[model samples]
Target: MTRPFPDDDSATLAAHLRRQAEEHRAKYVRAQSDRADKFVTSPRRVYELIRAGIRRGTMPHDQTLSEQHLIESLGATRNAVRKALQMLAEDGVLVRARRAGTSVVHDIVAVHDGEVGPRAWAGTPDEGRLTVDTLEISRISAPAVLQRLLGADTDSVLLLEQLGRMGGQPLYLRVGYCMTDATAEEFSQLIESNHTEFPPISVVHERLFGSAYGGSDYVVEAISCQERAAELLDMPVGAPVLLRELITRNSAGAPSELSYTHFRADRVAIVGSTLATTAASP
Candidate 1:
C-alpha cells in the first residue's frame, strides 16, 4: 500500500476528495428538494394563510403579528415571514411602520352577494336612501390612465358625473368613464334612468355587450378632497375623503368602465368580501 501511494501527493488527493464530496452533496440536496415538495410550503402560501386569516376575521383587526410568533406558529422561516408581511403591507392589508408591530387595518365586510359599490349604495325604494343626481355627461379627451386601463385606441371617452344624496344632503360623488362604443348613448340613457337606484354596472354591461356580468377590481385609498370633488361631495376642499376606484371588465377581458367615487367618511362605510382561503388587498 505505501509503495502504491508513494507517488500520490496529499494536496492532490485532498482536492479530488473535496470535489467528489461537493458533487455528492449537491446531488443529495437536489434529491432532498424533490422529496420535500409535498412537505415544504412556499412563502406565498404562508402569505395567503395570514391574509385569509385577516380577511376571515380569524385575526383581529389592529392585532400585531410578530415575526417570532409567526415563525413558531406557522413553522415558517424568518425570510418567508418577512416576505409575506412585506407583501401585505404593500397591498394595504397590514400596516408596517418603524417601531410598530405589523397589524391588520381594514374592517373586513362579508360581501357575500354583490359588488361593494352598488350594494352599499343601493337601498330599498321604501328605505329613503340616497338620491343620485346625474350632473353631467360629456365626451372628453381620454386621460392616460383611462387609455391604459381600458386599452382604448381612441382619444375620446364618455364621462358621467353624478352626486349621491340623502334628504337633500350630498353624500358621495361618482364619476364614471367608459370606453367609446356604439351602444354608449343607449347605455348612458339606462344609467341616467337608474342613477338614483344604485344599480350594479353589471346590468349595464349585459344590456350593452349582450354578455353576463364579468367582475371588477376595487382600490380604496385616502385622498384629500379637491375643489371639484369637494364641491360635488359638499365637503371642504382640504377634507379627507375615501376614494374608491372601480375597474370593471367585460366578458372579453377588456376593461369596460372605470369609476372614481368619493365617499364622505362619516356618511358611508365600505364593505368587502374575501374568499375562504385568500384575498388580495385593494
Candidate 2:
C-alpha cells in the first residue's frame, strides 16, 4: 500500500507569505516618509520652524527628529543634508540629544563667518554682540595627526590651542601650528596683550605676513566628540562634532599655518548666503 500525502496548498502558502512581506515593506516606507517630512524643507527653514514650534510648545518636548528626517523631508541627498545639519548643530542652533534626536536649542548663540579684511569686526564691539572671547592659549607639542596639517617636522612645530567662547559658553576649540618662530612669537605676544578678546587669526596672520592668509587647501570631516571636546562643549562623549583642517599659505604659496577647528554641535548655526534671480532680458 502506498502512503497518502497530506494536503499542502503550496501556492496559497506562498501567496500569504508574499502578502505579509509587502505589508511590512509598506509600513516601513510610510514610517520613513513621515519622519522625513518633519525635517526636509530648506535646512535653515526646517531649523527655524522647529525653533518656533518649540517656543510655541507645538513640538512635543519628548519627541524629536534626526538629521535623516531633515534630509528626507527636503528631498535632498543624504550627504548634503547631513552636512547642513552638522554645520548648524556645530554652530549651536540645534541640540542633539544622545539616542533621543535633534532639537532646537532655546538659548541664543550665533557663529559669524566674515571675510578677513578691514571691516570684518565693524559694528560689533560688545561681548554678546561679537561672541569673540579667547578662552585658552597654550604651547604644547603637536600631535602626530596635527603635525601632518602643519607640513613641518613633528619635532619642531609649535602647537597653540585656542578655545573661544560666546556668551560665556564654549564656541570652538582650535589647534594652530606653525614652524615660523616669528609667527609663534608674535602669536604669543598677541595672546598676552589681549587676554580677554580674540581677534580673528586670519587678521593676525595678515599683520605678521603683510598679506591676508590664502584660502585653506584642506578638508572638513565629521567625527564623534572626544572626551576633552565633550567636556569643553558641555556635551557627552561620542556626540557628533565637526572637524575642520585648514592649511594656510603665504603670498608666495609656502605653507604658513596649519589649524584644526572643532566646533560644538548644539549651540550654533553656520549661515551662508547666495544670490539668485530670474533674468528679465532673456
lDDT of 1 by residue, 206-274 (tens): 754467767878787888899988887777897887788887777777777788888775444566557
The local lDDT score (0 to 100) that residue 69 gets in candidate 2 is 62
- After superposing candidate 1 on the true structure, give the runs of residues whose Cα lies further than 4 Å from its correct spot: 1-128, 143-145, 182-185, 196-200, 277-282
- Model 2 agreement with the true structure over 1-282: per-residue lDDT tens digits: 642333486777678779999999999999988866653435565546555444344544444556566555456556655555565567556557677767655443334433111112434422333334344444566678666656656555556676666556666777767655554566677655444343565666665455666655656578899998789777789987767666778656777667777766554444335589888995
lDDT per prediction?
Answer: 0.69, 0.58
**What shift in Å separates residue 108 of candidate 2 from its native position after superposition?**
7.6
Residue 124 displacement in candidate 1 (angstroms): 4.8
By summed lDDT, the worst window of 10 consecutive residues in model 2 runs over 111-120
Q: TM-score of each candidate?
A: 0.51, 0.51
Among all windows of 10 consecutive residues in model 1, the one with the lowest summed lDDT is: 109-118
Highest lDDT: give the candidate number.
1
